[model samples]
Target: MTDSSAPPPAPAGPLSGLLVADFSRILAGPYATMLLADLGAEVVKVESPAGDDTRTWMPPVRDEVSTYYLGVNRNKRSVALDLKDAGDLAAARELARRADIMVENFKPGGLRRFGLDYESVSGSNPGIVYASISGFGSGGGASLPGYDLIVQAMSGLMSLTGEPDGPPYRAGISVFDVMTGLHAIIGVLAALHHRAETGRGQHVEVNLLSSALSGMVNHTSAFVAGGVVPMRMGNAHPSLFPYEPLPTADGDLIITAGNDGQFRALCEVLGVPELAGDPRFARTKDRTANREELRPLLVERLKQRPKMEWFHELVAAGVACGPINTVDEGVGFAEELGLDPVVTPGEGDRAVPSVRNPISLSLTPPSYRLPPPALGEHGAEIRAWLAEPTTD
Candidate 1:
């Protein structure tokens, strides 16, 4: 057997000394805490004996590990605790009481019975930054399970996706859950900063439905300001023409000619300068109004060239354009652009790569220090820590 008394490894990033008790399951909560872990936080993921549900959500498993589980769970330790058991519940509470931050995605009142709720833990650990993520708000919607699909359906997001005449479609990815997790991270960081200043903490709440609504950007604004519920326009932009993905000889290319100058440049590159000056397409509003008449012309021009050919020419001409690529292609493209999109976790095999956090903080860049843990892998270590007497 390995030497169990070896010192825990030192952290590599700025959040080196922070301890995070992650009592979340599935995507959103785990994702938020995983991001913190990536930045060098000591995240102790508390799972039920059955493990995170995503561990079983797979057809794509690597070495018997579910891709769904691997994707959001990097750089953390795991400790299984059956909260239903009094001993386990006490251990979980102790973990919370000692942690710098506590993250949970339990349904409203779900952990109250075990006294693991934020209110209960914060009652003693007043400095704990308690973050709760839910599907919807914890008010009237507290009891509802916050699935990404359900939130996408209720947040009017589905209605604004897909083709104009096609049924509402969910985004291929759980974008709402991802966004909610990101929002939660932002809130937690902000709360942590506040705590550092005042030596006090407060509850931070994030819900998928609210996050989805906020992420709607101008779509939600249009509805609120003008009573215009945005409808799906396929790959087209509601306010801009020639801003949609067009089919080319080889594949689809998105030509994002957002402004008049880009429109002129795009038209020039397409060998259709006259179209740029045409009375019907001279300005954004004009182009938007004349989209039906102009679309066929643009599509015909685009079809004559391969996507890469137009992509290169348009980008050279100062018009924003590129191929519509799949996830694999997107990752490769980011790599080509010198983004260094992937990072291998120090503790994981090559297959379990962690994507770098998009935020680039010059003073404190996020780092991938540890791979995701096996289920309850840190149970004994965490239990030992919890069993120690509190000094404060």
Candidate 2:
């Protein structure tokens, strides 16, 4: 639960006055719109009569609400519309036509028949920043659904996870979806900037496949430079050793000795100073070559101490080390470290807890001014705002 004593004062955030018509659903689109809302944009989440699929993705429900849906829909309003219904579709189109920015993750040509495609909407909303998120680019792979697991497999991300000798494993989180969302955010921002200069809008397209490839920066670099596809090395880095999780007496601790000096400090902290001077383990390259041999030595020595003990010792010795923590533990640890990562908005039956946006600007901090809405909760209010006569 989030702290609910008093609401934090709103910051002068970027996008403070922007209006976003969010026609996207599920993870990627909603996540991007959440970011916009965090920066103080008024996001209208346009959903179908059946609601977003995430609204039913449950197990951890609060007062019959899906926690999954609540997680990313914060600081926004919801308006239900059945696109097939003529009146509802017209309302949706009006919202998009008047919006400063419009985002959608519908399948390729899915909204075209309803006259909501970028080409159609931009015909009237010439200054709109239109953005689209998809599983793949609007080309050969556009017809396929954009599931995170499938993108992970198709983009070679699964190949670079897990143990080297084990079958490929998907990341526990929807990494591809998250990455695509971030990319969509970037595209929308860039388009907005471009519109400011040109006084005309353009279509911005982002897809899971491209995002996954971009997210694989370091791993892809290794393959492109060495002509060898990276194999899953589990927690071990391909180019560094003593950088993987080492077994401790109680649990596991990850050590990230990125440089020779850090490696030496780690060795001294582990009571194995001689290991740092050894010819086969002298430099980063040498450490990588002798990782298999060095791993066992570090593991054996680390096993003598508990994870917390080693973590403290390594930190004091200027070596990067952290205990492997679960999601709950990580959140708790952040709170202990004085990082307020959660926010509670308002006092109402529909109020929900939301995580603060990670990005921080000194003059423009992200906000949690509103809670996630109930389905069509703001339909009447938003339609009234839309129907009000515009001076322009």
Candidate 3:
């Protein structure tokens, strides 16, 4: 038997024997299942006949397929099942029965009528680790649709973003959705461990709003713990001075002097070492308190060199800094640092490029045995497996 404190090692990868019934759609649920699949779980993505909504999310397309869908659906098999149909409902229930874990993002109580909710499914599979993702909690915000932008606004992330005097702006990415998905992954993994120890699975619930609030970290703490509602500081950090992007002769550079030493080094690079000892800016806290008074002085010296030139100089001088990079340049920088940020999920010409799984397990690293599936690509096989006498 495996160690009681942890789930058994996967048959191939870290989670190889795990079977994930993914009855979720869009970003949050799909993203969570993809993480499990990367760890060697056999994830069957159960979708409506229309498929995932992201499959139709278009514009940035490759091979005529939605890159949005491709971005998170990798390493999983697709099995279309419409819950409204009796036969399909039976198939879905059977899939759930066989699943070691089940993930869903349906509205609160949405799956209860179909007998596919956690209560219903766990009736047959007592050891199933069931995870539910939602826009908000099931309590009062059940009806409110959970979208990243809405969460960003409601959870006060938008309030903390953008210019102090301008209207709040949404982040360039669906930050809350991704964060909630990651939280789901964490919950599922923990529940899996519990199941391994006691042979009893449990429900894991994560909401976008809650995740957003949690993701805000210091900002939220400022409001809740310190009785300070953090306002937008734009590119500047509210807690730290010299933490935002600074202009150079050619372009902008992101310079972060996080500590007194780094701040002193940054001053030295700007040929103003004496400024480090100045009473108004001698300490990190003092600098933050007097950043308005210090910004002009730093900007004047920063404009002497190009962004990249200053980046190298400051970095070498032990002050943390970098030039602002576009998405492609970011990837190139990762490559230059041997981070290997991208991976092709499978072999052959049809394999699509994807961001590599961030985890690095020495014993059982994540595998890329399969590319993302086409719509209903594994329907026949999955249905046949569900029809087996005892999938358990």
The most accurate candidate by lDDT is 3
Q: What ranges in model 3 sit over 4 Å off?
A: 1-11
lDDT of each: 0.86, 0.88, 0.90
Over the full model, what C-alpha lDDT does candidate 2 score relative to the true structure?
0.88
- Model 2, stretches more than 4 Å misplaced? 1-12
Cα TM-score of candidate 3: 0.96
lDDT of 2 by residue, 198-261 (tens): 9998899999999988899998777788787887887889888878878899988889989999
Supply candidate 3's per-residue lDDT for 14.
86
Model 2 TM-score on a 0 to 1 scale: 0.95
Per-model TM against the reference? 0.95, 0.95, 0.96
Instruction: Name the runs in model 1 displaced over 4 angstroms.
Output: 1-12, 347-351
Best by TM-score: 3
Clash pairs (backbone) in predicted model 2: none
Question: In order, what is each prediction's RMSD in angstroms?
Answer: 2.3, 3.2, 4.3
